[model samples]
Target: MNKRGKVVRDTNAGTGLISIDGQQFPFELEGMWKSDVAPCVNMVVEVDFGADGRVASVQVVPESQLAREQAEAAMRATKDKGAALGKEMVARFGAGTLAGMAALVCGWFVFNTITVQIAAGYSSGLSFWKVLGVLNSPLGFMNALGGAGGGSGAYGLFAVLALCGPLLPFFVRNPLAHLANLLPLLFIAAVCAIGYFGLMDGLKQAQGAALAFGGRQAAAMAAEMASGMMKEALRAVSFGLGAYLSVLASLYFAGRGAIKYLSSRA
Candidate 1:
């Protein structure tokens, strides 16, 4: 029987190796080639095995056959990957493709959905993936979240943790890994608090600057206007569905982790 392989190299005048099914087999270019010249590197060839299961002869396969074989190989590879992925999912979830389902849900509601709609704010309506990218840049976060700069960007750090820290538990061993259950909740809390405080801090600075320029005489009016300013500020920032959905995801992670942990203990 004959097999197909790509020529790996023409090492010398009459000797070389070819890769077949990912294994390299040496072939003699002497009388076995059947061609005037030995096959060039990267050329596909048909191989005949000897009684000892060694390479007997090799010749270039037809172009049509090469193309058909390549397509078939690609299809086989894709099927193999899909089968492997399905098996892994079943091993982990004990059922269907739970991971794929979660990813699809998250991709729609969390990754692609609008995070917030900011009428004038920088952080408005951007997808979750972009928000994650900008969270690392202090000025970027401030600009995106408020269209203003100067916040310590502590929320951005928490946001990073909220987005990425959950994966740690899956990779680490138990006990410590168990923290994944509660960590998401903590991260979400910390991010909310820090984000709110950062905004308030910026607002206060603006108010103080107003008082500084207006002098003590304007303090009365500043105090009078403070309540309205706070109201307007709160009204300007409306949370979008994606933001809420993201929190729900984090909550789900925590709840599921807790269930698994408790079940293990039981």
Candidate 2:
């Protein structure tokens, strides 16, 4: 039987008890309740009965509609918040300035590196390690131009450069904490670059010796390659400080714009 009822006892059931024609039936609520609005006690509801006359489907009527409206209102509020955030972002970065800069930097690296790798008969695929290598050292830039390097080095280099970028300003403002920030990137790159180069050099030497025993010139070639790799590692350590400085400059400019906008608005 199809009937309409009002919820009597809530009692924490998936469906609540309802009074229908002066009779109480255990009824289950269908679907989900909306956040911020819920079915009220004694709210009118519709129910379908099973063969045994038990409630098959129970739905709160007017209260459910109220819940739906509340949910939509909440969604609208969230959209407004998102719009405000967008406006704040635009004010801080000057509406595409940061985006354009990012595109330029990434594009320059990709275009240069991809072209060289393609010409060298390497597959036209990007390598994270290679990118890191470039970031860590001048050798990393060289790798993009057909030198040997990887992502670990590139990440290290970027880190080092970023750390050094804000040193002078920070030192002038707060010597102790600012100074601590300045050379961390370089130090990190140094440790990583040293470890990587050392491990690779040892491996190459071992391979070269094995090949030379078979009358190949592998050992001599590997030894020569090791010197160049070692040189790149050293260069990476030296240039880390410069890269850190550039990153700090970028962040400082971005932050300055944000502060100016906020002060003006205030």
Give the best candidate by lDDT.
Answer: 1
Query: What TM-score would every model get versus the actual structure?
Result: 0.54, 0.31
Write candidate 1's Cα lDDT for 100-132 as tens digits: 335424642355334443555444554444444
| CA lDDT for candidate 1 | 0.64
Tens digits of lDDT, candidate 2, 1-266: 77777878763656667788899987543443322335557877777777986667666667667789789999999999999997886776455444534433443233322222233344333232344565455445555445455555445565446434433332344323333333433443554586577667676767667576844576666666766866764443322222334344445444554454455456
**RMSD in order of candidates:** 7.7, 13.1
The residue pairs found clashing in candidate 1 are 116-125, 122-144, 123-144
Give the poorly placed runs of model 2, Cα more than 4 Å off: 1-61, 101-207, 215-266
Poorest 10 consecutive residues of model 2 by lDDT?
Answer: 108-117
Best by TM-score: 1
